[model samples]
Target: MTSLPLVFDAPKRALPPRHLADLDAAGRRAAVAELGLPAYRADQLARHYFGRLTADVDTMTDLPAAARGELAALLPPLVTPVLEQSCDGGATRKTLWRAHDGTRAESVLMGYPDRATVCVSSQAGCGMACPFCATGQGGLQRNLSTAEIVEQVRQAAAAARDGALGEPARLSNVVFMGMGEPLANYPRVIAAVRRITEAVPDGLGISARGVTVSTVGLVPAIDRLADEGLPVTLAVSLHTPDDELRDTLVPVNNRWKVDEVLAAARRYAQATGRRVSIEYALIRDVNDQPWRADLLGTVLRREIGARLVHVNLIPLNPTPGSRWDASPRRVQDEFVRRVQAAGVACTVRDTRGREIAAACGQLAATGA
Candidate 1:
């Protein structure tokens, strides 16, 4: 008789203590009460962290000295930078962060004339397993807690305010396009989104519209996010239009397929009245052909039709030892021309941070 399939359980580590940043206002109040502190203490902490954008705890002079230590212990630093390397004359900085458990993640801060943006990771590593992506190659370590994710933005915001990027400009935008798939870490990412978009003395007070969350077509999660009413831009990473190639490029395609993803994008647009962004990574001789770009436009136009969908074409930044390479300039331009010819907006992404291992998984390779 054939033996049954073997069962092997993966070992699980003890999850870290939940931080106040991970909790909403009500939840924070509940946690403070559970910690034997008065409910108003939660509001005080929120004001210090969210309003003042400081979490040193020493600055929280409102709390008694005796109680400060306990509160600080409970709200210990969630994301500590191991090393910070910058290129472009410090205009672009990439940070390697060590979490409470020493699991490493990376975020990039880019300064622009109009606005500054921070690209934060949603998971410790990625599980998408896109052969061309550096982060995907590492596989997923674990989902980062909401606080860990938000703290990256918080620090970047603080840096921007402190003139880290030439002149002070607030962190005007945030993108979840770092190491891991944002949708894969849905719970924490959603919580982080709430903490980011809510009004201050509770959140960073950034407009919900400034936040962009990219997903590799997790349809159910996409649909659920539409109902959230936060009005954040939803970017769908559609590497290729045809299912056969996408099946290999994005393995999740086998389950949800292209039509389903576009349909979900439609749902998101309808719900939030926000434009849905299509992210296509143009790889040489792989996905950058003129015909594929035309097809992408056709599908997006037909499926979602003038419902505010734009495409951001990224030149594939192949990791070390990877076979993929960025598309040539001629091919890249032709692809953009074809997509725009078909009546859908498309543009190449501004390349940044290539000098200092700009790709997500690169920094952790040498050392965490």
Candidate 2:
């Protein structure tokens, strides 16, 4: 077995000041008390930020003028919009955000007839170093603070309510699949998840089951999330089925291997009773062979069982100047056929925002 080097250090950068979204109810009360305001003020702040989805102190009319400003100063803004691009007739919008530290990250909002989903980044640039991905090729910038992550959702939720994506609909789903390896920023991502799923006046009130947290097979983090008792869906980006190829496609495969990742995913499925999502990007002639598809079906069924897993076949959205491209339609159909033939559920994922570079593996926000 060949050893693969792992790099976990994100560039040391100053994170933004703590915001109201970062702290829980208790912490928020403590923070308010420290500012010489009554602890009950924390609940008012929470109602404005989480329930009203407004961070502007002026909109919080229930609070006294002086107290509102003092509390707002303590929370501090985290995300500043750098650029926003929309496609699919304004049904899909991608926003590039510059954090207070000047690190850039992207969050995408996509609206379907039934639900609206936002894809958010947990880190600025990714450290995973997946050769085919635009974000991974850029290298790590820094982990996003919990408040920074939650702010993206708040903005998206507000956008949805404001009819930014067609009719006024609720932002119902969130996927941590934008620019970075989510589990690498474990603690903050978990905290953000709580803030996203908690009920109104405390957090975004999005259902935990509607949230999906993706990883490039971060084994330990997957196990840790399983123990957290939050029933968010787990998505493993297993670009290839065999270890030999996965080690090259998803470099983290070199550390945990394909078997280890599937086992951890199986444990997550059993613990959460939620079907694990296997994300396979079908790059042209790269790990898209018929045999690889067969192997994918075999291994998934063997390790995680057919009932507990579903494969999300992603048609590769090639980055600019990258040799990688999407597989041919016939090839993609055959691959799906093979996986389904193995008695495991599989479907081609709906590709969106390609014109605005918001598709899978295209979210590189370093320059935005």
Candidate 3:
């Protein structure tokens, strides 16, 4: 099959200023030295930002006034919340963030009884052109900077700490299943993940296992990520098990077929020992057929092994005016049954923020 004519690169746009989140330990120290500060000041700054979860230079009273002002330039705000919508009794909050360049991205913070999770965007918009997704239909804008991505998590974690989600829980999990195809903006996403999972003061200090990065089957990127040695979960958005329908549903399938994508996921699972999550959006009269469900189990079992994989079946969150709707409850149940009948683990995803458009681009669209 011919490759997709799609250009994975984002459109040209001016980027935001560099921030401390954009720098590694050594890089942060180098930056401080350029400002005539000692190298250890970088560690202090990190402790304030990543550890204490504050960017206000005023709150960093540990530093002399002059040094605080001098170091503050590198911490210029990257993401500003333009609007926020909440549902599920304030347990789920979605923020529409506008970058310094005025480009839009989004993040969602969901609170559970035991843990809180933040879903962050790696790009402002998407180029995947998945007909069922609001972000995909909106098309691509520019990619977010590394700090832009990290700030989303840092802010969400701080919000959770401050009881923005109620009951004051720690933000333990992060999923790159937000507005953009995370793997599309590969480098920044990986760097942001490192900054997120590293120890406090050095990074967010969250465990790497708490992080999950999803892709719509970018074959080469998947193989590359397997070698990163970061044990983050790999989630594959395999909306369909067959190529004929997938080529239409997920345009990238034109370039890499179902088997190719599954093989890459299998490789990642072997490399990381993390169970691969196959994300399938069950849409009515679309990919939710009984046979397709069985085929999904069979294909995943054959390609990625039943033991190393889990099926996360999502009820399609239809966009406004979209023709698509979620499958009936009975159909969804039967589909799950068939997949499980094939000896594969399958379950419906506990969808959050459905009333406020939990799908990534929906809030950004309204905020626009």
Candidate 4:
């Protein structure tokens, strides 16, 4: 079993009141017993929340009516929706959530012909200070609680079930590519992942293989996550290949360097036997030069190898008033051609909800 460390690892932040989603089976039973309930009530509560996808205690019919309110204490609402916007004819939806502390975060739910995926936020804002990211510019607010992260998935699953994105379908995947660097808020994010992928009545029960966690190449965290033995996919935001340019682009590259980050990603891939994803946001003429593309391909080909990795090129979703802009389509196409030409797999990411600010931190940065 992947162990969960103490709640919020970041300094001095108050831990949110314990929600059932924050606890393990043993912890849940103890919480229930503290409320003067029987041990069986814990499983019953889990069924309603995880299996039935209902958070309203009144709807948990199997539990005694008298105890419903008491059980409800364990289900304190963690994420409250502020605004929801849909584009692509309602096939893509973005939600802004306000935490109890008034800090805000955002998540995006996108439905495709074959699957539905929700991009969830692990923090209210980011501290990475990546020049192009809205959240990074806004600065870090605080890390979200485990339950706060899990609630976004639960609601998205319910929305998909009710056909929020056209015909009803299972929410097939969850990506930690929303507002925050997921690996920075490591413990609660891992706890939330377990809650998402563990079997029903205990969790949302989505396949571990379907979850992807994105980070700006936090090397130690990458190595630590590799030891957890979970099958979740790892995505390293490597925007550029050379250390000199990456230092200005990713910012965190100054600390870990490009080679160190890629080496850590290689180790993670070897440990899990999964292809690591290298995320490159293609900026117009900034990091989009043909030679840089070639360097990106060569570096990955040497560091991560051909079969062990894939590069996902994001047509840069430029933030408001930012100097950054996405590369031209022709340039983007050529970049992919050059990368693939080096014998490593590369593909352009499908940009959904661009008009509605679907990119990470955009919606929440609106204070919507």
lDDT per residue (tens digit) for residues 1-368 in model 2: 21122466567788889889889999999999999999999999998899888989988899999998899876687898978889999999999888787678899999999999999999988999999989988888898999999999999999999999989989999999988888888889999999999998889999999999999988888888999989999999999988888888888887899999999999999999999999999998888899998999999999999999999999998788889999999999999999999999999999998888885436453354
Each model's Cα RMSD: 4.2, 2.7, 2.1, 2.4
TM-score per candidate, chains pooled: 0.95, 0.97, 0.98, 0.97
Clashes of 4: 0
User: Which model scores highest in lDDT?
Assistant: 3
lDDT string, candidate 3, 1-368, tens digits: 22223479888887788899999999999999999999999999999999999999999989999999999988998899988889999999999998887889999999999899999999988999999999999999989999999999999999999999978889999999999998889888989999999998889999999999999999988988888889999999999999999999999999999999999999999999999999999999999999999899999999999999999999888889999999999999999999999899999988888888889899887755
Best by TM-score: 3
- The lDDT of each candidate is 0.86, 0.90, 0.92, 0.90
Q: Local error of candidate 1 at 262, Å?
A: 0.7
- On TM-score, who's better, 2 or 3? 3
- Model 1 misplaced regions, further than 4 Å: 1-12
Alpha carbon deviation, residue 104, candidate 3 (Å): 0.7
User: What lDDT tens digits, residue by residue, belong to model 4 across residues 248-352?
Assistant: 888888778999999999999999998999999999988999999899999999998999999999999888899999999999999999999999999999988
